[model samples]
Target: MELILKTPIGLEKIAADRLIEMDREISLSVKPHGLEGLIVVERCSDKQALVNYILKNVPEVESLVNVEVETEANLKSIVDAARKVSRGKISEKESFAVRTVRRGRHDFKSIDVNVAAGAAVQEETGAYVNLDHPDKIVQIEIIHDRAGISVTNGFRWKKMSPDKKPALNFFNKISIVQMPYLGSLEGAKEVGARIGRAVQAYEVRELVIAPNKPVDAYELNKFIDGVIEGIESRFRIQCKSYDRKVEKVRVSVQDLYQLVRDRSGEPMIVFEPEGIQLIEAATKLRKIFEEADRVNYLFGSREGIPKGVYRVASMVIDLAPGITLPTELAAPTALASTYTVISMIEQNIEDN
Candidate 1:
């Protein structure tokens, strides 16, 4: 099997070196080409295994794509490659889009490839064209005269092997904290400091904040930007925020759910407290989290979660018994609990 490894532009050799070291027995060949972060790997015994190994061991590798066809770069060749890969790969009921990355100057533009390949795939599979959120992605990489085609679904291409799983699963973790904007801007900044500490402690990368009532977008962004800056002072955890103007907790929660679904093409495992399941046992929570592709933890502000917000939750977990903590405390508490559960899960996996 053949595959493409995407790395930083100048770091292609680093990734290729690691692959060469790992492919001793498989006799794999790595060719760095296009000078555009593309490394082609050919003659592999197990492509999936190598991908898993690279993802776990090689930090420079950004993504991996299993190449279906590598042919001359042109509109007809790209259309034919898209058609061939979409035959059994993309279903008629699924929605698909064509994504083209052109490295060298050519007669055709990238949008031209996307349009032609998208039309061909739609005609061949009867699948609708969805550019925003596609069920299947037909990726075409054109470097000068050569082009590689592959069909994919999600952002994560490498799947970790069971035995080589890491302790902290950062890719699958998401945290949503409700901003306590009911108070003055100073009070909000204080609360932001606490939220920043929580995010840093938990090593969260994606954060979604819901502003309280009477808070506008400008104020919310200003407040949350302060919190993110505070987190950056001590520990470096790159975070992306999903800022919404909704005051209701349910609206923010639903927005986050939709955002995750749109980007990942799968439902996230949402956990919110409804005073039902206790968050005392890490083992039980770990088992539940292991089943999904990712986890989303939701916390409310001073007003607490809305009445019907629990309906969207996959599991309602009670953090504090018979008492509701404030947003500042609740955010950190839930994040710490999740980190502990994931740690225990990883420890158990390592021990076994």
Candidate 2:
């Protein structure tokens, strides 16, 4: 039976092994419970076969923990499904909450009246607009003459720790540059130089600056100059404005196949394509986040991911030149290998 075990970062290998062994083990002495089951993940292939094997051999095994066992390749769909099941909104404060409403459907005309009444009764301005911690997200499902009104907070809330957090500020920079609302070119340059120095201190290969809004072309140029002057050899800085427009990213599965097939080439193109793909996927994922409720299955077209399976398949493909992969896709690849199970998982998540 094959199982793709999912774990948080910084998990120990020994614990992972124990979890894997719980499915099946050759030696009963290893377990205090004297339980034994044997399953070899020879390759990261065939999810159904693995599921059937586990269910047939272990009748008590209703579901596997940590591992996402699905028949389809589209993980984005899975996320969307789960999200629908756990519908809620994320606040600017980085918190998730659920809403419920008693009414079936609300009319804007009536809603305005209610808002005005609420403001008048509450003796507060903008009380209607300030729908913080809304009592409910009113949902109305009308069927014939009968209607179903649901006030739902589907998913439970848990505080995500800061350590497990992904980078929030998408603008990848060594440091932040602060200037007055209308600062001078020198100020921009100084900010860029500080960022460059910070990037050098951190030993990063590249530093990027993303202005919140478009800047004067000359001022932007001066900022780049300061960034270039501050960094040492092998470090460079780039400045660009944040793109508000949504963009579509394309990747040839064949091109990725060939690149992973050849990892030792000069100017190692491994990082570039993967980074671009990830960025594009991230952007798309962000869009889906807006319509998270109605999103049924987030499958990419042929130009992108066909299903969750495509990204998973990419994970199995040889990432390093002339290298072998482990039975457990979660296992680490060769030290020299640029590909990793975690990397593939993250790619799938971002693509989703």
Candidate 3:
């Protein structure tokens, strides 16, 4: 079996060298010059064993594609190869889709290959097409004059991280609830209650409150503790303190700018009505968050974020366009919108 191992551009040689050093049984060759991101491996003693080893040991390798056929890169050649692979692997009762990726200039576009190859696969296997979710995937990769075809039987190849934590459920996310002091004690508590409800509704993991002038750290912490207690008592969920217990409400008191600066390594998104629209911002945020190890969202109070605080912000989102909302309303709106985008992206990742 021939497999295509994809690595970041300019790292193909390093990945190829590592594969050769680790597994002497497999014959590996870096794809010709100009095809800088791919290494072709053939003559593997065990295909699955090599895949597992690469995924576990090679951090440079991004993903692996099982190559069904390595032939000339052309419309006819691609379609014929895809049909042959799909016929053997895809059952007549299953639904399949053709996905083509091109790395070099070609006479035909990727969509052209997809349409022609998809038609050929359908005709050969008598299978219907399901673009969103398919039982089988016919993947065609064209790099200059060479092409690799594969029929994936619902098996996905992902690089494995030994130190990676288990995937998080809805409840496991580490979300921050930023409650800025709104001048009056009654006002702060009232806004805090609304923010607290948002936290409970979204199942946030952490709560951080900023002590604006006149509101000391002790007072802010006590106020947040009370707000959390109220939320628990109201919902009967039994929230735990920062020490960790049943409801699990970990609260902290810190300056908003200082908090953002401290967590600079994590992806940060601030919600401001003057910023970009939420929908477009959410798309970009999803990509950034996916690549980041941690994520934090910042919401402003009536006074708005402290001057120069936005320097640490990676993105500024306008959840409500052309209108300004009070801190209480904006806080929950930002949380709900951000959570919705994250959930949507997570679902897309799972589906694909």
Candidate 4:
């Protein structure tokens, strides 16, 4: 008949008062015996109604937990209580974990309780332990003299952890080879600026302006100026936003054909209509990205990349089968596609 609620340190009295006024059947104490930020309901008529009211109306409280079974604060007692609560609720086919949060000082650490209880639950239920992505979680909330044990479903939304391979780690190895978008000087500058921002958002290693053929000299100069401007503006924001050191993307210029011949050792990927479907090349692309130290992504301006260059390239990817993306959309899409398939590949590798 006890429910524990958590609030800001000084607001525990206010939260307890509100709860007391709702139902006279409950007797409660705010910050029981000088512990801060806790409201302990010694007796209550309805636990479900109180939980619903707090969630709908109470803004002062930060967290709330319903105590299923109250046992003496000791390792053996805690393990037996958890086993009783976890009976037919969890199956052996599902993965599970034990999470302990201890509030008061004791002879044993929180990890000790977790290990003892976890082993008991595993033996009783015959379920496997998956700490990172568990299907169910046995919650242990331990106070100074008493412990609360409950079994809840595990949260499965967290995509990145120390054990999981992050897709962002692979972005720094790519060099974007973009052709000069020539025509009007003003239009070229605008296109170049957008592409610059898109590529630098991921903090890619390099952005190479590669003109496969002769283009307007004035238009090229304006485009180059805009690229530099866009990079600095975005880099400044990144430096302020991120806690770690931020690196500006390197800008370089090399003719598309010569650059391919020079960096023949690296993997070169071209985005064009004549190439194979993305579904078909995804596995091969994942292998190339995993093994190579550097990857080159070639994108066209107004005209597509020359057909001759496709032969020497490692893979030609038609990202969208029937549709051609705009110049600005193309760079970001290429990066997104690369990250999506590679993440799936790494997850599969770990799973198998």
Question: Candidate 4, residue 41: CA error in Å?
Answer: 20
Candidate 4 regions off by >4 Å? 1-164
What is each predicted model's overall lDDT from 0 to 1? 0.67, 0.31, 0.72, 0.85
Worst 10 residues of 2 by lDDT: 327-336
Per-residue lDDT tens digits for candidate 2, residues 1-352, read 1332222333323433553454443221121122122122323344565556555654433323212222221223222332333233322223222221112233323344334333332232111222444433222222122222222332324344332443322212111212211248887666555544544433332333333344567776776666566554223322222223211111111223333234222121111112233323434434433333211111111132222233423122223334332211101121112223334445678789
> Who is ahead in TM-score, 1 or 3?
3
Listed in order, each prediction's TM-score against the native is 0.46, 0.19, 0.48, 0.58
Winning model by lDDT: 4
- As for lDDT, the candidate ahead, 1 or 4, is 4
lDDT of 3 by residue, 133-222 (tens): 678889887878889998886544434343333333433354563647545667667667776766665556666776534565555654
Stretches of model 1 off by over 4 angstroms after superposition: 25-36, 42-49, 155-352
Ranked candidates, highest lDDT first:
4, 3, 1, 2
Per-residue C-alpha lDDT of model 1 across residues 1-352, encoded as one tens digit per residue: 3787788878877887788788865543344343667777767767788888987999898887788898888889889988998899888999988889887778899999999888899999999997766788999987677888999993433344434444345533554645444456676777776776666655554566654345555556556765676566535333333122211111122343344445453223333455554435566667756675556666666666554545655556777666767667776676666666667677779889
> For every candidate structure, what is the RMSD over all alpha carbons to the true structure, in angstroms?
13.6, 24.8, 18.1, 8.6
List the lowest-lDDT window of 10 residues for candidate 3. 162-171
Supply the TM-score for candidate 1: 0.46
